[model samples]
Target: MTSDREQGTGGDLVATLIRTAGRRADPPADAYRAVLAAAEDTWQRKVGRRRHWRVGVGIAAAFVLLTAGAALLRVVVLPMMAPAEIARVDRVGGGVATRPAGAGAWVPLVAARRPLHAGTRLRTGPDGRVDLRLEGGVSLRLAVMTEVELHAPDLIRLQRGAVYADTGSAGPGGIVVVTPAGIARDLGTQFELRYAGDVLRLRVREGRVSLQRDAGELVAAAGEQLTIDTAGGVTRGNIARDDPDWAWAETIAPVPDFNDQSVAVLLEWVARETGRPVHYADAAAEQRAASVILHGRVGPLAPLEALGVLLSTTDLTYEILPDGTIEVRYQ
Candidate 1:
């Protein structure tokens, strides 16, 4: 019933349709490409998440290390400055007026002499007073009801209150006191400075006091004074003290223990007596046949001065602290 040409054309058409259906049942080239692209995207997302986690962990570790380093700086590094190293004192802050060595209330402007350590408590009543004197005779005195921090050998940061200073005889680099506002450098011999009420008050007695700002420097000479505000603004004038507070320096007593014992034994005794810590150089030499003639406080004073006196005794040398610890060596 069918013609030959019609039958052959229909068969060719059916064969073409079967071939197309087989290709569609499997995947086309574009479909393979789409699947590959999806796999790559998922891998990339996983990699991104891993990188983010690593970065976050790294940041956390860095934060912990930084915090630990700061604590070490405050507790260890700041206090280790040499005995010969110079220091400054200033006021920081306190919720109450006065706290003691265990109050955890105040921070010093410079490393404290025996009774003071970083974790020690600080108190300032309206009449609370504190003083710091470097081995080379630089001194800083905090007024009553003040708080401060001893940040470095030459750096002190005052948070609140007032401080008087006689920055004298610190070798070479001298002394520096920092406040909530600015820094005061000793170009002169003596100065009484107060950081309170957003004002830096300066009264110069003996030498010159230099008020330095980020912008410039203001020089105050003997009998002259200046005040600087938090804004780097400075005011200059003449200020004087009838009886300078330096009278305390005169009260420093001499060590008289050297009269009975050799300078070496004296140093050891002073170290044990005063309770200030001490270190020795050339321990054998310090213990050798060392003798000295005695004089005033240099003779009867604390161990530090006693060591100084012993050194004054022959070719020997020594060092002592305000708290009486002494270290000595014979030449």
Candidate 2:
């Protein structure tokens, strides 16, 4: 019962509301694309952050490992690699060599002035002899069938044999010789220490030495000899410094390099070797010796024998006094 114009207007209004509602329910294609792009961007950012975190962790781990390795090298590896040199092998006669620490086989050591490190074990054949020059001008002579260990520059262990130590003028920093029976400590002295089966002997040539055992201790001065028995009993007696028993030591004594050295220097060496003071016939004789320069080699000769050869070049002769003094005079 309504007019046609009113009915047409009402239909148009209804259609317009329906179109607006459809547009609100379904978004445009551009808006859907923008939402997908934002989600993809957020996912890519999260992946990048995780990758950066892994790289940072790896770098930190490597640094820690490097630091730990360096510390280990400094503390343990370097020290084991570098053992200190305490002595030098000056001479090796017969079949003298060294048995390295923790090694069973013996290695033949040639006389090439090889450096000897601490804890090196030395062994000699039946006819062997070896001479060692320790730090601080000390000399150690080992006789045949002897075995010794270098504990330090100022210390040695006499396992089984004889050793002559001359700690020349280097004030003793506790030079010790460890024997099976006892220990002999030098007081800036020259001495011979022998260790055999269940016995140890010490003979002081110049200066004092202290021998210690579980029983007690005794000091032996120059020209004194002490023996320590297996039972730790100590016995001491007088012995000449130049006794014939010491002749073997003289035979193996180290010959000084007298190149371009003064005669006075040579005389001083002879005095030390022979354990005697040199007496010049007069002040002129001493002055002449100071002015003269010696040239030649006294190779492999005993001290007295070498002295005779040396004086034969000049018009000088020597006589050994009863008091162990050498009187040098013009022929």
lDDT top scorer: 2
Q: Model 1, residue 196: what's the lDDT? A: 77
Candidate 1 lDDT over 1-331, as tens digits, reads: 5454576988777877887778556675434533443344346545865576567666797765666576566546865752223332222222223333345553333332333333222335564565555444556666666666543344555656765655545643365666544566777466666777777787776677776654666778877878877666777787443333433322232223345556555555444333344556675664463444443334224344555545565666655544444445556
Candidate lDDT scores, in order, read 0.53, 0.78
- Model 1 local distance difference test score: 0.53
Evaluated at residue 208, the lDDT of candidate 2 is 93
Q: How many steric overlaps are in each model, in order? A: 38, 0
TM-scores of the candidates are 0.42, 0.73
Best-performing candidate as measured by TM-score: 2
- Please give the TM-score that candidate 1 achieves against the real structure: 0.42
lDDT of 2 at 74: 49
Candidate 1, position 301, lDDT: 44
Candidate 2 runs further than 4 Å off: 1-78
